[model samples]
Target chain A: MDWRWDFTFDVVLPKMWEAAGVTVWATVASFVLALIGGLILMLLKTHRSPWISRPATEFIEFIRATPLLVQIFFLFFLLPDFGITLPPLTTGILAIGIYNSALCAEVYRAGFQAVPKGQWEACIALNLSTYRTFRDVIIPQSLPPIVPALGNYLVAIFKETPLLSFVAVAEIMQISKLIGAEYYRFTEAVTIAGIFFLVMSLIAAFLIRLVENYVKRSILH
Target chain B: MVPRIAIVIGLAAFLAGLSVATFAELKMFLPAILRGAVVTVQISVLSWLVFMAMSLIAGVARAKASGAVLWLAVGYIEVFRGTSLLVILFWLFFVMPEFGLTMSPVLAGVLGIGLNFGAYGAEIARGAIGAVPRGQTEATIALNISPWNRMTRIILPQAIAIMIPGMVNLTIELIKATALVSAVTLVDITYASVQQNQLHFRTVEIFAITLMLYYCFAQFVRFGGDALEERFSRHLSKRV
Candidate 1:
């Protein structure tokens, strides 16, 4: 195995870091979208009317049941047909956002359900509107607990970024693959990519624990 | 039950309508798609077996072992969990070959996905074991039950009940993982659809069919899981 340290340190590491910027930002953007979309889906799912809740639940299940890669492929392939050719990177962002949004929706559901039944009854007794109930009462209570779960999925979304390489997203995995192809040696670049994921996700997990502590402290205060 | 029945009926109606609309154009592609489906299911099961083995060995070790053995389990669980499946899959495909050990793409995929999801399942396995009531252990001790009998008869039964739901979720994920193998040029359902689309350019129709196929497979796996759970938990409600 021609593991060239000079080439790895000088040539590969810099390019890996450059490509990592794409991976990080895409994860952030997709996660932000997942957060918002999850909230909306959760609200829609728990809506009082069956008409609203039923289809919303099914759609969430469909998204959850299907592979994210297929969804990405579908959107990427279909868009070019309708004469709406976007950048593959943007397509990746949108697709990952949509797929993870469904997962986040389930987390939101679990969080909301964890809120005690009396809270809902209290809102009902006060004759609070649904919007007011969720806003002043439900959201403040529900959002905190789900942060750690959401953060876990955030790490998951980060790991998922490699799949974007399929559509030519120029993320670390794709960049490393290009390097390997060019150099005729895959071990060094690929190993570095794996190490980047392992280290960064460990750091993310650590940061998430810190955030979890912060959120818990704020709630206590 | 009524809503479930209605949903099932509704879905059947919808599929009937959709299939009628696309059947003519889809006829030629059905064989290829089915062949691809066979590959997908094959790899999903293959990887799932790998996942199940790793989950058991590492999970039990993490929960019950000590010293270097526990550290080995910890390393496997954390390393696999921390990294992405695609990276591992590619490493097995691209890097392992450099080590003078080459594997077919399918083997690389099964091992890659199995290793990744196995880490997750191990956590679930550990958690489930931890969830078993402490009193049960005390009772087994007082009754002078052997360790093996205590674990097999009492602890694992309850732990397995807790593990099933998480295991089911992971199994469905395994079905989905099979789709990713297509990225490595394995002609799974996803790759087949991409292949089909190039020929006829019926992008929407072909992918819709593929998605439906995958959804059905995932649902089938979920159903199996539910049945397994039902079997395991049947004794819980019995009155002694």
Candidate 2:
């Protein structure tokens, strides 16, 4: 019924700041993992052999189709039974990273597909090795367009960090829930957390847009 | 090629064998999981309808409405899009009760998913509408068509065609998002599987089923959306 400015500023704000660090760290770490995993998946799917590509494609599809929350739960709860227990933070990052890699893989694949067949033919005609073609010819060309899409996933994975809370990772959402339970006042803590998320998302979106424009302009030049 | 085919068949047999072993344990949990799957479908469908309605309203407002309405629509989209859906669900379920605006867990889930995805849908809608071309709207205006008629008869058909692919992506995302409803204590498939896993300690078997169910649902959305888009744009093809 009433807003508690004092409580929000003195208590919730400081706690959320600490939690925001964890949230940011988790997001960045997972994003790095996603980038690597996604590229690998994309390359596998684009392999010349169907034996390798078909299963890789199917794996990516399976991950993309499933929910991140379920994946997190599966990893957190089930892995322990196999004597493969991970720290909550590790599990959180791995779960989110693996889940998002599928999406990023699709983006990468699209990026690859968008390159004209002429480019590949030219590489072949020039006697470029496969590695040289991908590194020198394909990758640089494919990357710019994919940057914006990857950036979207960055923001997306950031928003999804809250799900880590479900598995007991002390991110902003988890901390806020604790604050709510502790103070018996849900409004201030939850509202502050929401505000934090909103601000971060807006900033990420702005940065991504800036990067997209810069990439476009550089490509044109 | 022969080796590849053999490998594929070998992999299939291995998976079938694994499933058969798991099924012996999974058989008892099938009913609960199925019931949860039904709930997942229900939530996705219900939330999708709400999301579509909100998107249409917000999207149209953002595209055409004047001044205050336009800002309000933008505000809605940004706030919902920017905030985490889990936080929103928690706020709806926990914080709203403090203000005497209590919602049932299911309602909270629906509202949360609907609002979140609706924000995304608004952007898609705006883009699709914008892509309908200036000439179409100009011709409608030249004909002195009513504003509603201009949108419905002239602009919307084309916009809807452009919108369907994006809408399908959003729908699939929404279906995946429905899993979050379990956090709010809704008996969705994710919740049911989690519960069954906790009880039986059969995480691999249970979640494997959950994953397959979600994949099937997503594929259905993809196929269905493609079919609808084909139907909607059939006239364009005929004209060509």
Q: In order of the candidates, what TM-score does chain B achieve?
A: 0.89, 0.89
Clashing pairs in 2: none
Best by DockQ: 1
Across B1-240, the per-residue lDDT of candidate 2 in tens digits comes to: 234334445544764686588777657777798899999998998999999999988998899898999999999999999999999999999889889999998899999999999999999999989887798888888889999999888887888888999999899999999998976888988889888987888888778778767877877777778789889998764432
Q: lDDT per residue, candidate 1, B71-103, as tens digits?
A: 999999999999998999888899998888998
Report how closely model 2 matches the true complex, as a DockQ value: 0.78
Q: After superposition, how far is residue B160 of candidate 1 from its true place, in Å?
A: 0.8
lDDT of 2: 0.89
DockQ of each candidate's interface versus the true one?
0.83, 0.78
Instruction: Report model 1's chain A TM-score.
Output: 0.92
lDDT of 1 by residue, A1-221 (tens): 66789999888999998999999999999999999999899989999999999999889988898888889989999999989999999999999999999999999999989888999999999999999998888877886889899999999999999999988899999999999889887899999999999999999999999999888787645
In model 1, which regions exceed 4 Å deviation?
Answer: A123-137, B1-24, B237-240
Clash totals in order:
0, 0
lDDT score at residue B153, model 1, on the 0-100 scale: 89
